[model samples]
Target: MSDAAVTADLETYLSERVRSTPPSGIRRFFEIAATMDDVISLGIGEPDFVTPQPAVQAGIDALNDGQTSYTANAGRADLRTAISEELSSRYGVSYDAEDEILSTVGVSEAMQLTMLSVLDPGDEILIPEPCFVSYAPTARFAEANVVHVPTSVENNFQVTAETLESYITPNTKALFLGYPNNPTGAVLRRDTLEDIAALVQEHDLLVISDEIYDRLVYGEAHERGHVCVPSIDGLRERTILLGGFSKGYAMTGWRIGYACAPAPILRGLYKVHQYMIMSAPTVSQIAAHTAITECQDEVETMRQAYDERRRVLVDGLNEAGLPTFEPEGAFYCFPDIRSTGLTSEEFVQQLLEEEHVACVPGDAFGPSGAGYVRCSYATGLDDVKEAVRRIQRFAAKHQNG
Candidate 1:
């Protein structure tokens, strides 16, 4: 066959879902920023801290001890035990390490595994947006129809029980929750979580709670902080809990995370996980175990830094006329630029061109994100301050003209 025929044949063989999912809108700006040296980039959600010394030393120690082989398909028992223990103490959720936990590449893989394992073709999953960019796409990739429950900044971008109820249909099989949510950094309060937990019982819905930023949750004493969804009454049995070392531990590149579920649900996830990823890296598993056991202080230290930067940046944006809501968790500040009369993309692009500052367009998360842009405070404090200053100047010139 000719070249065109061969290409067409391959395309025909590929699934439509695979072809239709768009590339990450986050990385597109990164590519543009890569070509410039002067850009103050707040586009990515990566921590500025180095990996904790104990974790780094643990990996180095493992390498020195020649620990470079593939672990069990379910990952190292000790690491799983550590995870299980931590979850038990921290969230009041219990699981047997051997049968109920499976370590994956990261929460990224955990999410995909959960969606694929639970979602039959034609089943529906409700996703709250603007959330992490992956949730909607991963569900679609699993051949599930993704129904978006749009949450607005007016409501603090939280999914209320009423909002979730409105989206449910007979085919809806699960709900995806990402608290201390990305972009908006909106953490659901306890009452709100109880509301969602009630829905889970009412509908018998499966849930995938991505709590990667659980450890990073911070707010005033008056406001309730991150509530682990599985710890809620009537939710643990059906929820597939996803978490990782990436954000809280400053180990993004290590690519290590884990999932926990009831034994039956875990069995389904393992079938997808085993064939796709035999095991997570031995070094990372060792490192994560050490960190979880020994590095609580280091995690708190990093959280303190993010909290300080979050305060300064959010306040600066609000004073700059951008109207940024204080993000109670995570490292991002989603500032409303609608008052400037610019779409998210237009604001992001022109700011990059004019001020050489790079923040992601909030619309990258979903259509509801159009009037905002997500500025990550994960960069250094100096850079965060300077970026806010530049943004203020930019906003003045564009002041709804």
Candidate 2:
């Protein structure tokens, strides 16, 4: 094509779906951080700890043994079996390793497979707001309409049955749920999940439950244990469970995650996954297998560290005038930044520029997350402490600005 023709027609060549969707709001700050030096970032939900030694060793051992070829499309039998056993042991839920699980590049891919498999164009997914940034976008990419159900700090930032019911329509096909939620670190309790499960069954809705942070619940949540939505009585057949090694095992770069559902649902998900990705990286799958089966102590140790960081960061933010809520899961503290008299983006940008401290604005998650900022305590404790100090200084200068 001629340059003139290319220039004129390029705009039309793009898919409406791809063009209409907005780029990541989190990446806006990341681009700015890239151009700077000496910035302390609380922006990413990544663990600072190295992958546990045993998992790392397992990956190395697998590679050294030349186990590099692809395994079954569903994933290695041993790995799937390990995951199945872990689910049963942890959640009292049993999933057949043969047909109920599909492994993918990451929970990110697990989400994509589930959404694409289940949602028809124009179908709507009811998502709780103040969610992870990807939930709505991924649903939209699947050609599904996204209806955000408002969840607030007043309810510990969780979607209630009342709010969820208000958004339901005949077109509503699924509920996209993430808890031990991102940006807010709020884990749903049994009573709340039971209520939602009842609604799900009543509505005949499919559920995409992202439980990536299930192992990180703290204090009361840790004691009660995170509830698997699919494990709730009759909801299992209708739920797609999404999880990965990134949060729980600090294997973000390994890019391994999985999905579990009833055979009928999982069959569709697996077909999509088989065509899109033949298998997750074999070495990473081994690493994940080792992590799940042999690294319970390491997982607990890391969770403890995050818990300590959580308390310190939340207390420091409140003392710094950011007025943070106590987060019970995940590694973030979403503090109200409206007190600084700036929008979420402005507060984050200004803090980054003036204090060399970086955090994600709440608006990146959803409009309900506006007037707040998500600070990740996934960095070193000292860095978190210093970030608190820097943020306090910025807040003091700008509180009335």
Task: Note the residue pairs that clash in candidate 1.
Answer: none
lDDT of 2 at 177: 86
lDDT of each model, Cα atoms only?
Answer: 0.91, 0.91
Error of 2 at 119 (Å): 0.5
> Can you write out model 2's per-residue Cα lDDT over 159-222, one digit (the tens) per residue?
8988899999999999988988898988887888889988998999998999999899888888
lDDT of 2 at 132: 86
Q: What's the residue-level lDDT of 341 in candidate 1?
A: 89
TM match of model 2 to true structure: 0.97
Model 2: residue 263 alpha-carbon error in angstroms = 0.5
Worst 10 residues of 1 by lDDT: 217-226
